[model samples]
Target: MAKYKAPLRDMRFVLNEVFEADKLWAAMPATQEVTPDLVDAILEEGAKVTENELFPLNRTGDEEGCQFSDGDVTTPAGFKDAYNLMAESGWMGLGGNPEMGGQGMPKMLTVLFEEMLYSANASFALYPALNSGAALCLDNHADEAMKEQLLPAMYEGRWLGTMCLTEPHSGTDLGLIRTKAEPNADGSYKVSGTKIFITGGEHDLCDNIIHLVLAKLPDAPAGSRGISLFMVPKFLINEDGSLGERNPAFCGSIEHKMGIKGSATCVMNFDGAQGWMIGEPNKGLACMFTMMNYERLSIGIQGLGLGEVAYQSAMDFAQERIQSRAPGGAKYPEKAADNILVHPDVRRMALNVRAFNEAGRAFASYVAMQLDTSKYHEDEATRKKAAALVALLTPVAKSYLTDRGLDCTITAQQIYGGQGYIREWGAEQYVRDARIAQIYEGTNGIQALDLMGRKVVSNNGEYLKLFAQDIQDFIESNSDNAAVQPYLEKLGASLETLMQVTGNVITRAKDNPAEVGAASQNYLDLFGLVTYAYLWARMVAVAAPKAEADTSGFYSAKVKVANYFFARILPEAAALAAQVNAGADTLMDLEEELFYGE
Candidate 1:
């Protein structure tokens, strides 16, 4: 409802204290060139850009929306200006590799900036976020010629990018996609199909729109194994690296959405468009994953940022809005009513949001740090370990952050009561915005299935065990920090419960096909809470010593939230644990005739 402010100081603390990202960056040769001063400088600049440039355009952009007509789409008023400002300031390429046109900032820091961008305006954030993901795929898979041709302009925001994957009848069921790519005499492919729910699908803000469309070759295998990724630009690129003529790829129509109204979710029709294959034939999913991985984390942070802003907005309102008296007594004898802050339940709800938003920030940055380690670190073992970490945590980051994003936003909305239900209050918008985060980018349920089925159970709990060992090691080493000991202990207990539950689910599901699917959502939530609990303890341990010597109340706040998380939130895992153990019989046993009170 109110203006958003970047939580710069809190972000800085998490990066330095909880993650010690600078030290990790200093060790990585690729990131060694990045200095703390540079990270700080960029953070300062990023905060201003996100707050001043992007935040102001949020409401306006939402109201004006994107104008779509006759194969053309125009961004909302002031969006083009805000985008160009981002372009000129080099914000678009903050963490882009220096080899291309990016500033080569650490991914650790970029995650925080991306959070700010999302918090400021999620609808507006889609353009650049998708661009960055497109750039990531190109940088990794495209040959030198393609990278040389596309990276600079995209990094500079002169050209934008879109991902075309979903077909009318296919989304989660990508195996059913009907898009096709036929080989051409020019060594390019003629891509033909319709893609729905394509973000950044069409816009006049850039000189060109680069599309990463997935299509199947004629000789390819059935299902997802057949899909291939192709680059289909709206305008044919000239040999001299200039714009030629309009290509066959164009917007068929745009979907009206519940939130992120400013973003153009278009139905893209690629009709015999000349497109270059991005990766090896039939390896499209992997290539697209390069971008999906980035997008997944970016989307997760979207929820995180919105949660932070919503929580902050709610806290501000709670402190100022005078309403009912304290339940026990009249605290404000001279006033007409007491502030809502006096209500214990309201405080509990507000504190829960704070706990997740802050801890979620640490968790996200920590994962980003792992990304940098996996990519830039020279040590083979470190890279391997970090890679494993990424595989283990990516789904969690996507699902958990957004799950909490929804929960925290709801809590913030609860603080507003009736006002939150009405659109005018803006609290409802955060809830709407947060909802998609759960559904899109591989639904949270899918994320949970990935974590439990692939990451945990498939490897026979190797990643699960390794990761828990890492956290347990931290707890053992830092047991001396009295302030965080209890939370750390609870995390240790939760980890044990998770392992036991994971093993039990795998064992029980061996006999029943539906068992795993039935318990997956609850299992993921349980896993996420444990992960956050560990991050919370890590935060408290780092902040306790820092707070002991400093005058600032930041660390004290950290300690309080960690405690609150343990006392108020972590107990839900017990309920989730019980539900996960119940198996599928309760859900699947009921006959179809039972519906309609049969």
Candidate 2:
């Protein structure tokens, strides 16, 4: 069995010590009620609930998966009870709107809770994850009356939600969708379409499911411009806020595959379903992006959560599994063989996973903080700046965290040697679950391309400049501190390398469009390393001064991990930068027809 205890200490360090989230919460009117005591209490309860209610179900959920028959879908055993427990406790709406009966927590705080959810059970986590993102989309675009009718119930978890965008023919290309929405006598539309790969599309855990669907109007324009969003429910609501009649939307079937089987990924068919339009008639893609962006970050958290659990579970194995003596000598001379913890290679693998997991947590929180500032800050300029930063980092967060997340899980699995391949130990399951995060919510490749082509090149490097300036400012501000000066110096160099690579890619893309795609993944990797380096510097600055006298060794361990990251990990930035500079010809020069048949 895998072991997982929420790293509340490190979460606090990132939120309170590193980011000074309490001060941030106090400064913002919306989050003013969130104090240190309240934050700690939430973390404590979140840890307990997730570990107790959800962790016990992780393996069982994976084994049982989801069951489908007729038009109904049933999640694995214990899922419905655990989900209701969460909803009744108001956890489903932890970050929802306060006016809609939600707890209205900040994203920074909720993100930590989300990590615990994913760590405990990634498959179970997808249900609420989709709900939260759907609620966010409806909240942003829906009118007051619709919000009143739907948001509260969705938040309360009486009715869960899902986003329906892909059809049988279209996945990433929303412009190619053939779904149609015809006007009805009342204000609603009659939606007719089939959407595939819909998470939480149909489930027995909740009373109804609200689908935010993408479709086209009768007189709409061509391609994506003709697309619109609709809110279709499994059961229509009556005037008195009760279930009236069953809508025509039905689940044709559910998918069976690699991982997250506990989540019901459905093939839905809407047969003239009664629906209402969201936003304008032809502006649905933009509206849907509101939810997509949210899910991208949430999916990234899925990876981080899986990585953390994998590391802890692997370390638990390392502590007791005797393999060989240390290179020097056996630490446990009386034992038949020393535990694997004595081996330097074992320590190396553990530290690699730990370093990324810790940095990834802090990085997620930083992005969430920017989101809070963008939404709640009083100053317009500050809000704009934060929003720009959020846009710049969202792709990095989604791609890099997940990419490293899969890598970390695999490495942790390797730590188990042959046992990791066996299903009974649970490390293999983490690998399977982590794999989907990279592919879904936009593949990591797509994310890297978005970061390079849209964010960096198309904007003329304006977004990159904002991020670079922040790192530069941090380095300059801490130049005088010797403890952090070394890491800061290296971070500064990495930032400069990233900037040079970005500029080169931008210039090269002007001549060859393929350059953008060729350079994208490498550029994103370089950028991710630089970003983690800056975060590690910030963490060490806070830890170094207090390390000597610390009894808990938390601060000391932080300093050591930061050292490992800077010494061993940050150097990858240079190699990636070189790959980015290698240009498009290396890939584009190949003859297309020659490689046709494998």
Candidate 3:
């Protein structure tokens, strides 16, 4: 595979030009200190660390995987050293709260840096990614005493964090979780149960691991309502902030997975581990969502990052690897045959990947900007509006980006033909690594259901309407600009289609609950398509005028990609709409036994 290079230029385009993130940052009091120069410096430094330190370890880390012996877990060679460097450089707390020893960067800035980390080494990225989510959860929900006790070391990276929600029998359904937390003479509880598929559950990269686990009290009610969140440390901490006796949480084993081999996926057994409750009793899932929602977006970036590297690597291959002559006839007659890129189909595949990656970057930044607004905006009403939009789009970001991510990786791998299958080329590793993003952080299917069932239908599409208005407002403001008129018209139509389908589903669901589930995935696809159309239109608006005067092909390429997205990709919305309107009858008609197929 080609050497991984951070897409700093494209990142800048998304943050500075497309989103005008600096202006937004300046307007918010919390982000007022974040100037354009500081953001640029952060981006440059982030690119260097991810490219120089993390990229070198990716192949070797995947090759080495993680080691497990007895109760201890060991990460791939060089991982500990790299983690230490990130920690010492204060990179771990790049987005943590300022009062908690963090650098207090906005989500808009951190998401771009996260993309670099995932692009360079997804396996290694999991360690810090999980830490950030866990830290966010603690900062948001835990009281001041707990924050003082935990946030400092966690932000400093001396102690890392993990979210333990799934078990062998229960994955998505929190109500069925059998983990039991018994109250002690002291305020703490004894958390005892086995949790599986715990990422960073037990790794050698940090001095201690803080697990935000879900459990139930003996007298609690049944189902999800009874669940409570707890903070279980691998090694207990003394009152003076020094290390104390070892906690009962132990790594029973680690899974040998298809990809992300460098990241340890462990089976953890909390054998009467001393854990403190994070929030009110039976409100665990609500508190844990603070982290889950964070992970959902991070997982989306996992897909975006992998898709980007895959595209670049495939393009690199296309430059050197010659195959048949071009369809128009030998473009490179000086060589034995034209490069594979001369083939229209190859270009199609490359363009497909590029369109999604660029749009995904913009989409992620859009969501991050909402997160910033929800958190830092002084006006209560504005914060509520931004928070609602964040909730509405979080699922789309997680599901759509990942779904396209897997497709992009496969397409990139196909560019290599037989060479792509070989492990040495590195394309196959990307495909393997990208696969899990869709499955974890609430599977794409679940995300769609959440979008259709909860975020949209639960409120009668109020949140979605709020989002639609934002796009509609943009279209109205730019209706007169001839250069962007075509894009605005198309975007307006797509927005109309999305609103129609959404209203149809909401009406249909009143009679048949199954309609929501049946329409969910397709509805999500339609929503995602329209959302990308809006972003592409905005990108074109910014790049159209600059393309004519710019010496670099950046603006021109951006315009071309936007055109491709509108002309070629946006049409998929129609097909998704049709599928969403197909109703649940066809799906529910088959008998349960028929599905088994005698």
Candidate 4:
């Protein structure tokens, strides 16, 4: 059995000690209520809930999986109870609107809990996370009547929620979506579409499952500009706000996926379901953006969560499993075996995973801070600046963190050797579970294109400049820290290389259309490597002085890991830069038929 432990210490160090989150919380009156003690209490409780309730069910959940009968989805053993606990404890509503009965916690804090949720059970976490996202859409774009009728119950966990954006034909290409929304007499819209890969779409976890479905109105224009969002429910509600007739939304079937077995990914058939229009017609994409940003970050953490869990399990196994003689001779000769950690190569892999996981944790928290400011800052300028930062960093958070997360999980699995490949160790499951993170939530490839096209080039690198300047400022301020100075210099050089590469790619794309797509993924990875280096530098700065005298050697370990990352990890930035220059030819060189077999 996997003994799941939330890295609350690392989380607290990143948020409270390094980021000074309490001060940021104080900066915005909306978040002024969050105090240090409150944050501590929250982390403690969250760690407990995750370990005790969710972790025990992870392997079992994956083994038993979810059951789909007719149109209903049944979660594997212990999930129903877990859902009830989440609802009753108000964990699902942390980032929800307070006006709608949610706890309305700051996003910075919410993301920490989100990480733990994924770490505990990625498959199970999708249920409440999707529910929260659906509630966010309704709270932001739905009418007052809709908010009054829907949000409280959803927030309270009596009802769950889902985002119905994907179709069988249109996944990332939302512009090609064919779902239809027909107007009705009572101001409601009749939505009819087949939405596939709908997470938490038809779960029996709650009395009702509210779906924020994206469809096109009868008079809507072509492409993405024409799409609109609708509030569709699995079970309709009566006039008194109680459960009424079952809605037209039915699960056509469920996907038999590679992993995330506890999450019921439904293929929903909405046959003229009575769905209330959200926002204005053809403006649904704007509404969905709010939820998409939320989910993108959530998905990134799924990668982080899996990576961290894999590292922990692998580390534990490495410590206990006695195998082969140590390279330097035995530390435990009397026991007739040597612990795996004595091997430098094994330790190197474990440390590498730790380095990536820690950096990812910081980057995610930093992104969450921008979201917090965007939503709650008192000044409009402050809010807008933060909003742009959120837009700029979203792709990085979604794609890069996840890509590294997959890398980290695989490396950690390698630490387990053959045991990692087998199912019983639970390490293989982590890698399987982590793999989906790269593909879904707008596949990492699409995420990179988004970063390049919208964030960098669309505004002619204005947002990119702002982001780069902020990183530069951090580097300049922390230049004097002897422990982190080397890492910072490497990070600074990578950023400069990134700037040059982006300009070349954009200029090349003007003459060659395929250049952008080819350069996209590598550019994203290149940027991510640098971003993580900066964060790791910060972590080293914060930990080194405090940890020097400790008997546990905890602080020195950080410096060593930071040194390792600077020596090994950050050097890859240059390689990514080289790959980016290879350009569209590397990707489009071969004929299309070469990729397919007759």
- Global lDDT of model 1: 0.87
**Once model 4 is optimally superposed onto the true structure by TM-score, how far is the C-alpha of residue 499 displaced, in angstroms?**
1.4
TM-score of each: 0.97, 0.99, 0.99, 0.97
Clashes of each: 0, 0, 0, 0
lDDT of 2 by residue, 208-256 (tens): 8999999999999999999999999999999789998999999999998
User: Model 4 Cα RMSD, Å?
Assistant: 1.4
Question: Which candidate tops lDDT?
Answer: 3
User: What tens-digit string does per-residue lDDT give for candidate 1 at 1-598?
Assistant: 5558889899888887678787887887777767778888888888888889888777777767888899888888888888888898888788786899888887888899989988989998889999999999999999899888898989898998888888889988888999999999989999999999999899877899899999999999999899899989889988788999999998988888888888998999988999999889999999999999899999999999999889877877787788889999888979888889899989888888888898889889889988998898898998899899899999999999999899989999999889878876678888877888998889998998888778877787787777888888998998777776777778889999998998898888788857678878898888888888888888877877777677778877787777888888899999999999998988998888877662
lDDT of each: 0.87, 0.94, 0.94, 0.88
Judge candidate 3 against the unseen true structure and give its global Cα lDDT, from 0 to 1: 0.94
lDDT of 4 at 295: 91
| Segments of candidate 4 deviating more than 4 angstroms | none
Model 1 superposed RMSD (Cα): 1.6
Cα-based RMSD of candidate 2: 0.8
